[model samples]
Target: MKTNKIIVGLFYLPMFGLLSCNPQEETTPQYKTIQQAIFASGHMEQEDEYIISATADGTIREFSIREGDYISKGQLLVRIDSDVSNTQLQEARVVYNDAKQNSSANAPQLEQIKSQIDQSKTQLNLDKINYQRYADLRKKNSVSQLEYEKAELQYKASQSSLQVLEKSYKQAQDALQLNADRSLQQVKTQQAILNDYSIQADKDGIVLEVLKKKGELVRKGEVIAKIGSGKNILKLFIAEDDIAKLSIGQEAIVQMNNYPDTTFTASITKILPAFDEAAQSFTVEAAFVNPPQLLLSGTQLQANIKQQGTKKVLVIPSAAVIRGKYVELKNGEEKEIKIGQKSGNWVEVKQGLTEKDIILLPKGKSKEEGVAKPGGE
Candidate 1:
């Protein structure tokens, strides 16, 4: 009985030993196409959208269009209260007209000067004739020397008076011309200011928002409306860590949360040089090559930007690569590896790995657990 018990115990001991030992789980490197991509979250926005602001301060008297309205360049969009501007312009026009009349050849001031000069010329002519007669009488001794001298003095005084009047007239004409020119310039300036009261569209676009309504007081430089150029595009805010992986002209796959089944394709068009402090990310812009039919501005979306094109390379599951620089063998031996491009699920083995190499999964995980299944099954 003792010998039979010992044999049974020995058999059970071997069974326990076999049960305690764990089998080695291994995976081989694969020669497959690997793509390097970066994940980003962003929204859709019009590439040419901009804000329209008031040029002059006034209350909005009328709005020619509303939100979602298509408008053209130079179309009047709003009319501010122009009572003050109109009054100013009218006053300026009156002043300008007065100055213009004064500057004209038939002006009352010029006419008065001409009439005075004509009268002075007539008096001078009479004085000259009298002086000539007085000189003849003095030579013949028919009139006194005092009479001839008085006639000469009268003629000389008349000549001086006429010259003075002509000079004064010319001076008056010059002054009137200067005043007219100044008033005309003021009128032109006033007219320009009045035009500011009528706000017109600077470019052809769709009105997305009307910030100031009728009768609302708008200050100069205040935003009154938001306009969009009617072209829809995607705007993304990529994390600073992932910015280095992106470049212009790379392909991007876009997916919107609202439309789960649909996917859109785009290509990177612009990368802003400055970082957006508010979003804590870098701004990037893309245009759709094959866009969704009903994409609207301000729609939220997620995108995966492919950084590198697909290439046939030695690849392994990300879990099989330890600390990104080495891989563990099935025999518990670690080997240093040089890796290159990496995606979320896999990493490219640039050197120190090949398809023939057998790598171990992390401890306690089975081959099926750590290995990326074939065809992502």
Candidate 2:
């Protein structure tokens, strides 16, 4: 019976206790408990960091500011040597203006042409009536053959001339229409080129980087500079483990090495549903409800996102939790528990334990066995 009790004690010890002076092929286990809470690792970030790119290909003529220079709305941030583009644009504008003026002038003339055409048709109609009367006289033999032949020739000639004139009028009409279409197109092209040459800032911001140097060639839509307002905001990249616990409007505390004592008050304004593909983090935007005066742009920061869930929780260090599924309880007492949000070195223990429990760390373990070794925490 004493041997049986000792054998049972060996099994209940922290990690698997090697059978102490016991039979071969026998070992004991131990366990422990630990405090649990949700944890995460996140970096502090700025609210706005907008990228500025060029709209068209050109040489960098000039930049209004250097990197880190603060700017405001309506700032002349960058300029391109659009001299070539400008000249081209100017030429285009001249052509467009001339074409539009010509089109407008020709448009009014169309009515005059139509009236002239109507007058010509009326003259042709009068000639036809005269010819018909002459023919009737010839058929009645009232007129001599020579005179009748002359009259018949006159009528035929008039008909042929009218057809020719009509063709010419139609041709003029088509040419004017074509000119109007072409002119309108030229105007739009000039407008686009002119817009490309002038680069004005779209927002009130600071120039973070001058991507292109003066006289350097830049492609349209290529990044010409990086810009952002010195707006007081934090862009925290929360760890995937802790991302689920965060919700919009939850209060957060942001910290930076520059201002350790000063905790910047913030609230979650946005949370990305998807994780960043490269960083494996979820983006969370925080608004500074009570901002410190010292908060500046691009300052590295850390954030403490508060949890609103008030339900009690159990948690332990990952080291204390043996294996993937279980943890060592007090003095080698082993228990199986479900885990929760894992911030960093610590993981939340949701099941099989309570808060403030002192848990033992499973320091070492054999690779082959499911059990872990207790180095005695």
lDDT of 2 by residue, 25-134 (tens): 22222222333323333544445677877877878787767886777766676677667766776777677666556555355565666666677778778877877787
lDDT of 1 at 215: 86
Misplaced by over 4 Å in model 1 are 1-35, 123-163, 257-260, 276-280, 309-377
Residue-by-residue lDDT tens digits, candidate 1, 1-377: 53354346445744665765754445777766756566667888776898878878999998888887999999999888889889999999999899989988899989999999999999999999999999999999999989999999999999999999999899999999999999989998999999888888878988888788988998999999988886787888888988877889998777665554456778999999999999999989998886776766678876768865666877776667676478998678899997654444556787898776778767554423332221101
Top candidate when judged by TM-score against the true structure: 1
Model 1 RMSD, rounded to 1 decimal? 12.7
Q: Each prediction's Cα lDDT score? A: 0.79, 0.62
lDDT of 2: 0.62
- Model 2, position 90, has a per-residue lDDT of 73
